[model samples]
Target: MRKERILYIYPTLSSFIKGDAEILSREYEVTHFRVHPTSWHSLLRSLISQLFHLIFNLRKYDIVYIWFADYHSFLPTLFCKRFKKRCYIVAGGYDVCREKKYGYGSFTNPIRGFMTARSIKNCTTVIAVSKNIKQIIRHVFPSTNCVTIYNGVVLKPGKEDVEKESLVLTVSMASTAKNVFIKGIDRIIEVADLMQETKFILIGTERQLLEKIGYKIPDNLQVLGFVDHSHLQEIYSKSKVYCQLSRRESFCLALAEAMLYNCNPVITNIGGMPEVTGKNGFIINEYSAQNCSFVIKKALEAKTNSLGRERILSEFTIETRAEKILNLLESN
Candidate 1:
């Protein structure tokens, strides 16, 4: 069969610049239509030019892979409808499930609902990252065909004992921002600072507000911002835990990577995280920093290294997710 010319649309180039797109492209002729951070000068510019590109380019590819973003997905819907193409949407988080419940700021709730409704209605298929998201989509768009494909990372198990240290980690784009509203950064900071022995590393970008808070970030809590994806596995290998404090996530990719490296998870019991962690990690509901501390203690004590790594390797892999997507496309 001739290779399918797949056009993958994501809000930013970051998603495609990362592992998922590269891996997917190995099987399909993938082209990415993405917006970079430097390009968005103002709202008027983005609204007019970007939207035009998104709409006009819809007919160019045999298969259009739309990333799950409520705002961006709206513009593409115009093209999808106009061209009458087969499209598949990937729902990763918040915008798909949160916007309807809490509503996004500025953008009218009805508009988001309509855009999602169109994408859900017109797409060939919808891939929900977790069961929780699948349930929400089924509830919101009853007619849409949706499937659960958990996010994952390709793991190369390391030798040396990971017990080299007893440290917990929270990885995100927000660095040292006192108000880490996204991904529960503040909560992780609160939880990390309260605990003893367990060190926290804040990888990604740096935020100024975090330094002013006077939380007295000890020598243990290191903020190494913006790490390369290749280095993440090594970071996981040296540690004993991965903690994601975010209230909303479609699937915590970092948590999965940590699990693959034999680092147990101490994640918030939300979204697809519970499904991803399953029996391998400790889950905290909302707050309860005391509980976060306790669970990390227990996971450390249990020393479920081989078993935890096994779960991630068997169940979660980018290859597996890509294969699932391929199967769905071929089946249709």
Candidate 2:
């Protein structure tokens, strides 16, 4: 049979929201829809564009693939259901972790009910990026099809990991996971306060509101605004340690990226952190200032060299993640 035509929908092209579904498109005839999914109202604008695409050429594609968080998949899945076409949704991370983290009371809590088991049952399969996400999918779908595949990360050698002077950087969205709460920013401040020798940097913006609300930023802590991967690489290359202390996460690309760069990671014991870090990188439990200080101190003391670098290369590489994902997708 001719290779199946696929259309993968994204929130926007500028979000830098990378996922494995796009990798499939590269091998097949994939049409990527970069939408702006800000709210339910945003769908109005998206529907206009998508309806045009659907009416004009929906039949040209064999599969309709949606790459986004929960509820957002409803748009594409609706088309597939109406047309009786085979489609798959890629639950990057949010589909699985968000509802659980925020609970059924939050603004997005309704996703728990609307984006339910029946949604997954109506499709061929839902691609979950992490094992935690796989479990979440199975919990929702129960008896439907669910496949767990990691996000791709290509490993490189010689660009080996090395400890920097006192540069600790956190590269991520300012608002994701309500960073104001249990995320590591507070602890980063605490860590910085404890060790005056280090400069704690919080990269990325979109959280100016929270930052203004007494986020406990200290003199040692540096808010570097937002820096892309090219700039981030230079920071990571010169950084000593990486920290990921999120209240919730499915598969953190930044954490994995930090590992590939060989920055010794000091992560919290939650969600996919333990799953990804394993015994490869330094890990911590509590997000308290006290605990953050302790963990940072310990990680800073450890040897950030070839040993940790080798582990991330062997496992978290994009090549390996892509191969796993492709094999899983092709097997079905």
Candidate 3:
């Protein structure tokens, strides 16, 4: 039997995007197209290249699978609609959000917002990473076809013999100043300052960036640049608690990964954090440092168990996502 051909398009090759591609590849012929637009010039160049690519290659694929509904997705969805091809767009938080304060989200910009909304409307289906995101999409575009598909993670078994320490951890890409605020790095620093006894480890951002933003690094907090998966797993094994105090998050893969390692989660009640945390860990309704510090203390003191690991295994495994997404694409 001949497998259907799928054209996979994404702005960046994130782990979740790569996971979806791998899933689709098991049952379909998949081709990857990266459209990273870091600047205005790059955006124009990417669009031109994509236009040409689709113009010449659109007919070969049975479906167009896009990661996010942003400028990169506008052309693919538009082309798919014109050619009567099935197009599925996975909507992460940024696409449907309108965070004006930090200038986050595609909707923060007028032109980007229009293109993103149109892309969602034109696509055959929009896959929201969380129920919160699905609600946002329906609220903004009432008639758009949308469904919730939680982002999946590969379960990493935590070593039972590994001694977990009094360490607090968070993973985020905080290269830019806006990202520092959006990912709640500021909050982490504040909490770290308040809780001087507990050690805080922040991965995926550099100490230089924090210093550049005029943030004084506390003695107990260790800021690290991005580390490989093996190193991250090692960090997860030793950490007692994982914290995600983001202003916005779609599915929070890091939180899930930490839970898989049996790290107690202390997250804000924002976007998908609460959904991901469920009853497995602590949730902080207030974003203040005092409040988050209090929550982290409680999480650190809580007994370690396999409940977090069990939740990920049952609900957010890669196998579950593969089954659901494959069925959706094949049926529609």
Candidate 4:
């Protein structure tokens, strides 16, 4: 049997999408198209160019796989109507959400919201990253065929010999300035101030901005600006507990990565975090500093186990995700 050709489209060459593209390429002949934009002018230009490109070349591929239902997906989704092409959209967090508090999310903008709705409504399938997201999609695009496929990661389990330190770790991108508060960096700082004995490491690029926003850097809290992946893995291994006290999350990839290194999770009970942590880690029912502190303390006393890593290996590997995707493609 001949392998099918797939045109994989994404807003940018983001790490997670790049990982998925690589996995998809293993089984299918994949051509990648990136509609990345740095400014409003560029966004419009890129969308126009991608639309023309898709319109002219739509027949070359057997399927079109698009990531996110924002501006980038709009054109291809529009052309799919005339061409009658089978296109699948993988909904990342922001594109599928209406996180008004942060003043972000595709659905927050009227134009983008319209584009997102049309794209999702027309796509052959909608791949929601979590069960929570699937529910959101069903409510918003009731007639659309949406399915839950938990995001997967490349697991590089840390060696058992690395002695776990008395450190608590939380990682963020820091580029989303508002997300510092949304992802509970503010609460992390508060908890650090109270738990003066324990060391808390917050990794991200916006440390300066976070401090500028009047978050007093406590003595026990160490805000290490951006670290490379290897360094992050080392920190993940050394940390006793990984905290993800977010207001909402589609799937907390950081928490999952930390689990791969055998760090016990202390995540908030929001979105798919509970699904990711499962019964292996502590889930905070409340988002108060007191509740987070209590959970961290309890997580510290609990012995580290392979349950987290084992759970990910069985269910959330990139290979597993690829297999599911392939099954979907072939079945259709």
Models 1 onward score TM values of: 0.85, 0.86, 0.98, 0.95
Whichever of 1 and 4 has more TM-score, that candidate is 4
lDDT by residue for model 3 (236-275), tens: 9999999999988888999999998889999888998878
Clashing pairs in 4: none
Ranking by TM-score: 3, 4, 2, 1
The local distance difference test score of each candidate is 0.70, 0.67, 0.91, 0.85
Q: Which segments of candidate 2 are over 4 A away from where they belong?
A: 1-3, 14-22, 82-84, 98-108, 154-158, 161-163, 176-182
| lDDT, candidate 4, at 214 | 78
lDDT of 2 by residue, 72-131 (tens): 466567777889877776675555544445452222566444654445666778877778
Better of 1 and 3 by TM-score: 3
Arranged by lDDT, best first: 3, 4, 1, 2
In candidate 3, which residue pairs get closer than 3 Å at backbone N, Cα or C atoms, i.e. clash? Answer: none
What candidate 1 gets wrong by more than 4 Å, as runs, is: 15-17, 36-47, 50-58, 99-110, 160-162, 175-179, 205-209, 212-219
Task: Encode model 1's per-residue lDDT on 108-218: one tens digit a residue.
Answer: 466766767776777777888889889988887788889988776755667646454677777876533422565677676677777756677877746355666554555
Q: Which ten residues in a row have the lowest lDDT in candidate 1?
A: 99-108
Model 3 TM-score on a 0 to 1 scale: 0.98
> Weakest 10 consecutive residues, lDDT, candidate 3?
154-163
